[model samples]
Target: MEENKREVQVTLVESILIMIGMFAILGALIIGAEMPPQIPILLVFTLLMFYGRLRHVTWDQIFAGIIEGIKPGIIPIMIFLMIGLLVSSWLRSGTIATIMVIGFKILSAQFFLLTVFLICCLIGITVGSSFTTISTMGIAFMGIGHILGFSAAITAGAIVSGAFFGNNMSPLSDTSNLTTGLTKVNLYDHLKNMAITAIPSALITLGLFFILGRTSSTADLTQTQQISQQLQRSFNVSIWALLPILVLLLLAWRQVPAIPTLLVGSLTALVVILVSSPGYSVSQIGTLLMNGNAAKTGSHTVDRLMSGGGINNMLGSVSLIIVALALGGLLIQYGVVHTLITSIKQYVNTPGKLILLNMLSGIGVNFLVGEQYLSIILPGTTFMSSYDRLGLPRKYLTRTLASGGADVNALVPWGVSGVFIAGTLGVNPLAYVPLAFYAYIDPIITILFGFTLVTWRYRRSGKRPATSTATTSVGLKDRDQPVN
Candidate 1:
């Protein structure tokens, strides 16, 4: 028994060391080090250090442990592939292009920045993807920002804020779904409850962007026109082409399986392409689906913005998710994550306190471990019981964890989401962190709502249960008592 305890302790220490080494390497990679070399270097060091302390553990065992750690993420991985398919098909059908042209027509230099924020908010609510919104429409706005003489920093901020704000509120988002599932909350009710806080945060952000947009005067009509023309000429943009996107959104709202939802959207897009863009052959369409859209506009900005899903586009991101989750799995299998969560779980007591702790822990794990999904799951499972004891609705807890966990991933430079977004956009994560107003505001707003009793439902005075389960697993079941 003593030996087993000692083994667990040693493994935890080794895992900590490995995490530290990984962050160091991640730092190097962010600063422009080659990933290929950095990955092997860190792996070797991690293996050697882990082996030294837990020498009895075999390499095969460690590898097995890592695979087990990643097993839980398989569902999310499949969802990502579907997301890739969805983006590819949607783009080919002209949904994204139509939105771009429409967005361009309505946004003047005076209102462009605010418009970007508003559009991001709207699309984010519809699709529930901050990353997708940023990668697609956000990229186009960067060009628009450049042309309009707006600061890239500010433009990036608006995009980040708007995109994440909608993601937080969107019922279709994975983070949102996971949160609701973990807490056994009704998804729509959870969203309705969040409106009390989310609406304020968004309004405040929109107001700030509006003021900034009006005060900062920089506009290049010629550049904006060129960008608009570039988009118009590149693909067959029409209202009919937007049907695929609408279909995908409708399917998601119906809570259909994500894979089939994406496949349906892709099929619709292919049909649209075949019927509308007769210049392209079926073989060429196949290539575009596999390789994604590339800009032929001869402008780097336009080219970058036009790029969307092809099966190939998901490779790098998929690879990153696998490694990061594998490492997470290893930490879990070896008991490192168990020890950490067990320790963090001791501090939470009241519902308000639990909400705050979950938010902090989610942010902390991201900062320490440099991963986002684990950041959400760990704190969420660890603090579930605390919410039950305080008679707080599970949705509040779900909203709290997600608002803090998933949205701000790109702010931490060493974190996987942060690194990936930075690499894709060619902008440093730190450079954009300060401007990510919604990222910082989300947790604060969610926490404040919890403490103030706003939009919170709990046990009624006449119906309070004499005894309630006070364990993390309780949130997984229904609580029958009426909420205050």
Candidate 2:
């Protein structure tokens, strides 16, 4: 068990200062200079490595730190590439177009926001990807809302809220699966536990949108009509177009893994496109899958919304994840994270305090590193022994990671999720932050519940639950033992 990497002793204050410095630099770069996050993150990483060496950490350990941290995210990056392909394929097949047409047909302008939220919630769970839902359905909603005289920010907010709801709860989601796998939690049980806070937060978000939506003007049916007509002209939008989406939903419902399900979705879309589009050459179809569909629908909005996908589009976000993970690896392996977390022990002693700490820590990672993969992995791994020691059921730990990590990333303008959503939905990430009601609300609700101990499996005897074996890993217990 001891393959012996050198440990560096770092003080808590030094760790906090390092965190503050990194984030402060990031904040200035993002808010003041409006520079790409990659630059600032690169600077932070360099400075952090220099800081580590100054404290007597070896060069080999420094490199090892980043590698260890990023190892967990390799699968997520693959899943993201799959999401890009899935979206592009679905676009070519007219699956998303059909859904948009159906949405505009059923939704009155007055109630569009709520519908977007609910439908995104459904598709999010079905697809198990916030990025896919936002890029496809969220873009459609943004276009329709802009024409309808609704604030694009608000529309984006609803999209973020609903999309992440599924991202957290969907058994097929990479984050959902990653959180469970990291914490040794069962995916289904994790979903059940998440509903305690998620459903109510969703209802609240829905009601808020419903109230705000009343102010939305009646959208000119022309935009919707033009888009729908373009849909028909560019690709065959028929009931048959629904095949890929239905297949995706079916695969997800049957508990298929993400990579294969996405592969199947892509293949389904390919077949649908080949059969539906008249005389489309085999080479052309191959090109579309790689370079992505170019929607030249004459309608700018339609072109903008439908014209993106393919693995190429996912590289920016994937690079951000890799870099962020490398930074996290440095902090963790070198004891910067350990020092800071250990220093908080006195102030963050209670379960409530721990929840607050985890939330803030997850959010902190999001802000500093600008990626949710780091957010979830850093907190889950950092506090694993702490939760075990306190006898807090690991489900609480997993839920905290999801609440703070998965849902919190998009709230920051510079975060990886934030940048991607802004680019895809054509909305400003900062402007939409306040409107990302569900993303922000989930963490707050989790913290409040911490203070009251509501819906939490509090530690009763300073021991793991009977079903949880010492060697069995965390979050694997059949049931949480409630505290008195």
Candidate 3:
């Protein structure tokens, strides 16, 4: 009787948490206050209600839940920390300053404008930061595009699509790192898994951009030359400064852990900084890392582009991550996550249906919350059990989330990625939604893989005939292997 009563209470709590999640989603989409509504949604309402409803859960249990969630986040968090140290070191090392100068020199030429899109794509892949790529190269591309008579919307679309492609696939990217961490998969494995979908999407986008470039008229030569010359005059462009970036790449290639790779790279960049910019001392470098690089480039345009990525700059994202993870823990404790997964699993027993449901849930949540991280975290937590039950590897779950959740925000006009791109490119977000090939291809390909059962791994005895797609009771675990 006591066991039954406990189960009943758990059900009631889950139902209430689900309702709160619904409200939180709705509020974030509609609310237009200065602050994003995700804070209230995750912290104030969801977390408070979760704690209040968990009278049966002790303080130790609650703490344990929070720790459990955060423990998994350690890898991403460590990567972020190293990124901070590296960015600081790189700025001090004069790598960014050099990249800016060289980038400007290219903008001065005639045909250079046409190559800007492709170049951004390459850099995006290398750096794995769409935002950083955009703020740096994207700005230059915009300037060149203006001179070349390309519409800002088209240029922005090209930039966003290319940058996000890299972010989606790059082992160094925070989102990619986070996704792998959540699913307990290898970073390289996730990148390799994505190529099945990513390579095709990129080729199509490149072809489209090639056509767009040909159709657009060239901007005035004099204006293009003037911009390029101005860029060169602003910063010292040296090939030696680029060594740190090469070093950074070599570390990633060796599959060194992100924390150490970033730490070594940052320290190397700082050594370069001493060689290039003797204007500042060691103490000043420390200050700059904490406060971000304050560009004294004297050109407002140049300054705005290069001045970013200190420990201070990462605070907003850090705060949001901590809060969101906390709420995720609360939801798990209140049984909200289990209830949703169990309910969804009952109707989605087959591998194909399970994959489809995961994709839709991820996309649906992205559209509702207007934040990319939650779209991933909430849906990932909500659907993990389903993957385990279906004998699907957690890697597939992680891969599906990346395909459907990570970059799907680029499709929604108001999503964090969408809004930022729109603001940066000086184009309406809605205008470019249809043209974003990568954003569209992700979910479509993921769903197709599900139905086709292509590249599926399965346990020996539980294997269904090639023609069979029936539900099984043997229990699924990853691509292969029976449930333990």
Task: Give the candidate number with the greatest lDDT.
Answer: 2
Winning model by TM-score: 2
Alpha-carbon lDDT, every model: 0.68, 0.78, 0.62
Ten contiguous residues with the weakest lDDT in model 1: 458-467
Candidate 3 residue-wise lDDT at 27? 55
The residue-by-residue lDDT of candidate 2 on 148-267, one tens digit each, is 767888899989999999788787788888898898877777788788888888988999989888876656777777777777788667899989878877887787877888889899
Which order, best to worst by lDDT? 2, 1, 3
User: In model 1, which regions exceed 4 Å deviation?
Assistant: 1-25, 28-55, 82-94, 131-136, 139-143, 151-153, 215-217, 298-301, 349-352, 368-372, 390-393, 410-427, 448-484
To one decimal, what is the Cα RMSD in angstroms of model 1 from the true structure? 4.6
Model 2 pairs in collision: none
Give candidate 3 misplaced runs (Cα > 4 Å). 1-31, 37-39, 42-47, 54-63, 88-92, 104-160, 163-194, 207-227, 349-351, 361-401, 408-437, 452-484
lDDT of 1 by residue, 1-484 (tens): 3234335444446556756766676667645565542264346446643754466755555666666656755765665566566666666666677776776677788888788898889888877766656755676677567667877778888888888888888878877887777767788877876776778888888888888899875786777678778777877688887787677678757867666876787888888888887777878877887887665768786776666777787666666656656665556555665665566666665555667777877886776545667777887887766666655566777777777778657677645566555544546666778877778777788888766663245323333322443433443445423365
